[model samples]
Target: MQWIEIVVLALIQGLTEFLPVSSSAHLLLVPLFTDWPDQGLAFDIAVHFGSLLAVIFYFRDDLIKLTRAWVGSIVGSGMNQEARLGWAIIWATVPVGIAGLLAKGIIETSMRSGYFMGYSLIMFGLLLGYADWRYQRKFSANPASANSDEYHLSKTQIAVIGFSQALALIPGTSRSGITITAALLMGVNREASARFSFLLSIPVIVLATMLQSVELVAEPLPVGWGKLLAATAISALSAYLCIRVFLALIRRIGMQPFVLYRLLLGAYLLYCFY
Candidate 1:
């Protein structure tokens, strides 16, 4: 890959990985539009690993606290809020993991069509907008309530969000977007919704990266080590910055901008593909 392709693909992966916009869709569309050859399995693994590293690094402190609390509760210590939150992430990840395993073949085959992705982008964009609007209404009526105990969630609520996250398997139904939409519909505050969505990403990315790594090892593709290293470093830096800025401004700006962007992108895809 040329330096330009490396930079563009890496930037797209890093920037869109956490955003409500679908990173998978962007990655799929880029080569199609640019007429570039596929970036191959090795490149895919590198960029995804970069994203995983970014999220883990950004939330290092929270992960430490959650890890200790979760382990403590498992050892018969009384469950506390942190422990519960930790358990929430674990339980919430199950549905998507199962869905991925069961639907992997279909998702990799039929669901990659541009038309399907276009419709998914529109459908989920509208859902995200509705959820965001609902959250704003609730926040307006009870401002103080929005900020109080943001991460506190009931088991049923976590399960609901977990199941909703499985929708992300579709080409354009972004993982972060779907999860955040479910959380918002459940009345989680913006910051909390985003935080949980991001935290929820850790395990999924790890699993995906591991699976791709195994595939790459089995096939043993000739990889450009220099390009792979550059992709990883560039993607990591961009992803970390994206996370920091997103968390900082999510409350102030809300999800409307992303929704609008998704809608426009979806429409364009539909027009082009059809």
Candidate 2:
């Protein structure tokens, strides 16, 4: 890939990764539209690592507390604030982890097909729109108590959210978008849902990136080190900014705008494909 392509891909990866717009969809579409060379598994892993760093940096303090709490909880110590939250996160991750392992081959095949990609974009975009609308109604009808524990995600809720996350195995069905939708549907406050969704992403992304990196080392891509470094830097910088902007936006306006954007983008992709 040229320097320009690297920059563009990195920017897109960073921005969409957290924006509730599917990063996988954008990664596939951007290259298709721009005629850039295939961004092989190595580049994909590198960009994901960039985003992983952005999230870790953004939530450094929270992570430290959560890790300590989780370790304590594992040893049968009394649960603390961070431990409770950490357990909730682990509970949420279980379903996705199992599902991803079982369906890896099927998911890979679907991602390789443009038709499945277009269909998923349109379908999930509509799902997000409906979810946003429904969540608005729930919040307006009965707002959550201020004193309610923000870290609490019931076992059922975690399972439901995890099931929703499995949908993200589809190319255009974003992990963030689907998880947020599930949380909203389960009566989680929009801001809280988005926050949790982001937190939940760290483990999955890190594991996936590491595995992909190993694969890349075993069978190197055609690209060089220069291209890889440039892509990683661009992805990290843009991802940091995108996380900041997205968190602010969710606070201010909820997820409706992102839902609308997803819908429109999905429609355009469908139109092009059809």
In each prediction, how many residue pairs overlap at the backbone (N, C-alpha, C within less than 3 A)? 0, 0
Error of 1 at 214 (Å): 1.4
lDDT of each: 0.90, 0.80
Candidate 1 lDDT by residue in tens digits, 1-274 = 9999999999999999999999988887885669889889999889988988899999999899999999999999879888999999999999999999999998898989778888999999999999999999988898975863335898777998899988998899999999999999887888898999999999999888888888888985577999999999889889999999999999999999999999998998888889
Predicted structure 1: lDDT: 0.90
- What lDDT does model 2 reach? 0.80
Error of 2 at 110 (Å): 3.2
Name the lDDT value of residue 82 in candidate 1.
Answer: 87
Error of 2 at 221 (Å): 4.9
Q: Candidate 1 at residue 98, lDDT?
A: 95
- In candidate 2, which residue pairs clash? none
